[model samples]
Target: MKIQLLVLFLSTVISAFKITDGTLKSSKQELGFFESDSLRLNSTEENLSVSFKIKSNTKPNQIFVKLTNENGIESSFKPTTKKSGESYISKLSLPFTKLPTLFQASSKLFVSLVIASEEDKYFETVGSIENTPYLISKSTYKPTEKFQAKPEIHHIFNEAPQTVDPSIAVVFSFLSIMTFFTLIVSWGFNGALNFGNFKFDLSHFAFIALIIGYEVTFFFYYLGDSIFTTIGRVAILTGPTVWFGSRLLNYLGELRVAGQR
Candidate 1:
């Protein structure tokens, strides 16, 4: 009789529970309950809380709860005990920063738990994060205000080649300023410069156009998300820089020849 009773007791003890259903809610709304082995989390502007309920089983203290990702990353937490009517549940805030960066912003995360009162060992479960809404992805961003949503733009650049350095912008600006001053000095020498008998002031217009083109091209291309942007940046900047440099040299040569004559 003792042996039979012991076998029955062991059989009745649920060695583990399968994560059956999950519910998520934000401050404004319930995102809707989902049936999943893994909890889908979203990185949204709203604070999200998710709770997972197990199959019909006697609820224990659930003294230990830790979440792990596919990468073996882990975060341990103690959920506040609660009963929703008759059902037992444990709640974990989604995208928990409470623990060491529990899940990467948009990657799949696995879960692990142990009811210390019921068992001594922690075991892995099918439970995982399903979605990350506020995950800082490029697909779901809108720039409403004056480039207010810069992070979305920045994320695009992160996936691409390095942007133009600050030094490049500084160098270009200096070159533009110096070029304008040199043009003024050259105009004083030539009494208004001309090109090929067109009798138009090419110096002023060409210098301003090249400078504007250089700044605008590099600014956007540096923030772009393409391999070609990097390659094209070199080609683009070369055109304006070479044009300005050669034009300045040609102007100086003309003044020198006129002085010799």
Candidate 2:
């Protein structure tokens, strides 16, 4: 009778072990509960406190708490656990700096408790706490003032482009005029201004007019006309200027030759 009882006791213990082991291996088994009230914010240590429980039958090789911010940033934390009667209580102090910096007081973070079991080759997400408020005191941010007309934005535009000083402009203009007159006087003294060989014809006047037109074109270019436009105008005048200038020079050459003879 004593030997029979001993064998039955051994069989009962073996069956219990098999059942517990099977439960640990099964992914469908419910893990445990999370105490939301157990969540704490430690400002001094700069860490967040989180607590959760796991089944007593299983001893997990690792336990992790994952936090996901609104922006999809994820952070994982490993917790130190303690063994309770029917469950293992796990708590972790995650550094606040480890969380996503964009987290605000109004922001919600998805919390997940994951466990890796020695009996199982894969990790399992057992429990989750959804829409956990970002509880850190510093998470509160000052919003912009609302419902009031904003201060009129006085745009500080850049000043308009300035030209040379009036005095300097005047001085340069006087110098240029004096240079022009000096050049004419020098030409007259050198007999270069003599119009004896000059012909009062359409070609001569046209050549002179084209030369003045070139000066006018340059003046307009300096006053902000597009370089392409100036170039186009100059090109149109080039053919006429060339023809008239060639004819005037040939006529002068003939006149000079005749005078020399």
Best by lDDT: 2
True-vs-predicted CA distance for residue 251, candidate 2, Å: 0.8
lDDT of 2 at 107: 43
Candidate 1, 195: how far from true, in Å? 52
Q: Model 2, 90-180: lDDT tens per residue?
A: 7765555555555434244545555666453223222232223434456544555789887788889999998899999999999999999
TM-score top scorer: 2
TM match of model 2 to true structure: 0.35
Q: How many clashes show up per model?
A: 13, 0
User: In lDDT terms, how accurate is model 2?
Assistant: 0.59
